[model samples]
Structures are given as structure tokens and as C-alpha cells.
Target: MPYATSAAFAHDWPDTVRLVTVEGAPHTGAWNADAYAYAYAYAKELAAFLAQHT
Candidate 1:
């Protein structure tokens, strides 16, 4: 989905939604692209989100 759409969805549920944007990452790059520079940061953000929510 487009970033704007995602951002809007998150905005609709501000209390329970979190948005993480990787500036140069592709559609799935943040999670699946090993060579992408921000892959580790994506994982770290996901971990942090899980830790906070769980």
C-alpha cells in the first residue's frame, strides 16, 4: 500500500498504531531485503514495537 494510505490508517487509530518509514526502502525491503541498509533498523523497530506491546 502507498505510504500515505498506510499513514492515514495509522492516524485513524493513533492510540494503537505505529508507523515506521524507511526512507529508501522498497515495498518489502524493510523486512526482506538483506542488503538494504535499513534492514537491521527495521528489525530493531519491530522488536521494540513487540516488546512494548506484548
Candidate 2:
């Protein structure tokens, strides 16, 4: 989704939502081999989020 839309959605739950945006990243960019950094960051973020929530 677009950044604006994502921000808006996060706005609805300001206290609980954590929005992480990767510049110039496509929807599936994190899965691409060319996007290793983004993928690593995504995985790290996801792990942190899950750890916090669980």
C-alpha cells in the first residue's frame, strides 16, 4: 500500500501501530534477492514486533 494509506491506517491505532517504511521499495521488494538489506531489515523488524506482541 501507499505510504499515505499506510500512515492513515496506522493513525487509527496510534498507540498500537508501528509503521516501518522502506524507501523506493516495491510491494514484494523484501523478497527479492536484490533487496537483501530490505529483507533483513524486514525480518528483524518482524521478529521484534512479534517478540513484543507475544
For model 2, where is the 10-residue window of minimal lDDT?
Answer: 25-34
Candidates in order: C-alpha RMSD to true structure: 2.8, 2.6
Question: Candidate 1 lDDT, tens digit per residue, 1-54?
Answer: 887888898899988888876666676565554455576776787999999989
Q: After superposition, how far is residue 30 of candidate 1 from its true place, in Å?
A: 5.3
Once superposed on the true structure, which residue ranges of model 1 sit more than 4 Å away at CA? 24-36
**TM-scores vs. true structure, each candidate:** 0.59, 0.62
Which residue pairs clash in candidate 1?
A: none
Q: After superposition, how far is residue 43 of candidate 1 from its true place, in Å?
A: 1.4
Highest TM-score among the candidates is held by which one?
A: 2
| Global lDDT of model 1 | 0.75
